[model samples]
Target: MNEQGEDTGIVLTEAQKRARRSRSIAIAVSLVALVVLFYVMTLVKGPMMLVRPL
Candidate 1:
């Protein structure tokens, strides 16, 4: 709210919008990479753990 105590919405500039988009894409890619890493780890450990003792 401004000095008048009126509620105002956010407005993003062109550069700000682009930066936000870039950050969003980077976050999405990082999330996907992490998921893939977990899947690979499960595949690599799943069978061996079943046969091997704790």
Candidate 2:
């Protein structure tokens, strides 16, 4: 029992930390891949893709 008036004994294992890090890295890589794919698609589509109708 502490300031919160309860036993706040929560801890993460080494394997859990590693898993979290791996998941974070995977998400970052996925986002970067999506950005690259979008850029490539824009280039392949040409300027016509940017044309807006009024």
Backbone clash numbers for all candidates listed: 0, 0
Prediction 1 TM-score vs. true: 0.71
- The collision pairs in model 1 are none
TM-score of each: 0.71, 0.67
Candidate 1, run of 10 with poorest lDDT: 45-54
The clash tally of candidate 2 reads: 0
**What are the root-mean-square deviations of the candidates from the true structure over C-alphas?**
4.1, 4.9
The residue-by-residue lDDT of candidate 2 on 15-43, one tens digit each, is 99999999999999999999999899889
lDDT of each: 0.90, 0.89
Writing each residue's lDDT as its tens digit, candidate 1 over 1-54 gives: 878998777978999999999999999999999999988988989877467575
- Lowest summed lDDT window (length 10), candidate 2: 1-10
Top candidate (TM-score): 1
Best by lDDT: 1
